[model samples]
Target: MSILNSWWRALVALIFPPHCPVCDLPLGDEKGPICSPCLASAPLTSDWALRNDTPCDRLSVKGCEVRVVAMLKFHKAPQWRHLIHQFKYHSRWRLAREVGRLYGGKMAGSLFLSDVDWVIPMPLHPLRRMWRGYNQSEELARGIAEQTGLKVETKSVVRVHYTRSQVWRTREERFKNVQDAFRVAHPERLAGCHLLLVDDVLTTGSTMRTCIQAIVDAVPDCRISVAVLADAGGGS
Candidate 1:
């Protein structure tokens, strides 16, 4: 059976060769979603697992203690932006997870998830999730969990209110847009657990603030840590 399955996979690969998501070139021998040549051009941040001030200071307002580690710097170059759009807007969830795996392996070697009790992907509103067909953040979290052996908590917190796009909004506008947008389910179940919130990108930190507010409101003692695949405005 195992040999037959291998042959079946070989046949499938022969029938449909994989191509790189970024350049659309035949992947050839590359094992990653993005071809190695394209992946090398990605703007990776200097610090992958180290506690960085960029994201930490962004959400550290409202007297909440937060730590952050960002993988990509989110360069505004066309290739980088297009790559994000491919996964985020083009339904490439596996690309998102594969990107997560890229950094999750490094995190496993560091103290990033050492003390985290839960890997909580920033929840998407049900309507948005349904529209997109999958939560990219959750896929990223799953990839990280696969590497770090952390538990992903999908149902504990949810986005109750669907939000308008925050891409063009000012920092203040973004905060107002997401106010009271998240709700914690059965807070007692996660009373003292340490939560490592995962997101594909870190923008103005408004959405995260409200989400953290919701979680802390429900479970006051739960520690909060933030991990983002890209930092849109990390050091601003």
Candidate 2:
């Protein structure tokens, strides 16, 4: 079965070559959904290396702080944006997980997630999830779990209200869209837990902040942290 699987993979690879989403270059080996050069040359922020960073500061609400780590320094480059778009907007689910796995491995090398007890992916409304077929953040969390040795959590937190896309909204508008949008379904499952929220990107952080506030409000004793594949650099 193992030999057959290898041959099957090789045949599939030969027929449908995988390309690095960031550079649009064909992958030279199985080690990539992203080529090493693109990964190395990409603008990475210092969130993973430092405990006190922009993501942490921006997510602080009412004097309560949320620790965070991110892999990329999101830029305006089309190629860079496409890397996220391919996995998030397109049906490139495997690419999304591979990105998560790659980023998770980097986070594993850092002290950022040292105290985290669970990896919780920001949830989507049932209507939206039905339309999208899969939740990008949940896929990301599972990938991160593959490297971090932490359990991936999905059901405790949920998006109860439907929301419009945040892409073109103003910062204030973004905050408004997510207000009171999430709910904790089973507070006991998360009580006193150390949660590491996972997402694809952090721009204004309205969504992430609201989600964390929901978790903390329901399970007051749970410590909260955040992780993202990229931080687009917005918010306080």
Candidates in order have lDDT scores of 0.81, 0.82
**Model 2 Cα lDDT, one tens digit per residue, 1-236:** 99999999889889988788998889876486889888778776667777644436667665357877777766644477788799778888888888888778877757778778889998989998888888888888898899989898788899999999998999899999999999999899988888889888888888888888888788888888888887777544
In the predicted model 2, the residue pairs found to clash are none
* Residue-level lDDT tens digits of model 1 in 2-90: 99999997998799887777677899988777888777776776464554434376776464688888777656444566666778899
Question: What's the CA error at residue 156 for candidate 2, in Å?
Answer: 0.2
Model 2 accuracy (lDDT, Cα): 0.82
RMSD, one per candidate, in order: 3.3, 2.9
On lDDT, the leading prediction is 2
Superposing every Cα of model 2 onto the true structure, what RMSD results? 2.9
Alpha-carbon runs more than 4 Å astray in model 1? 1-18, 51-55, 76-78
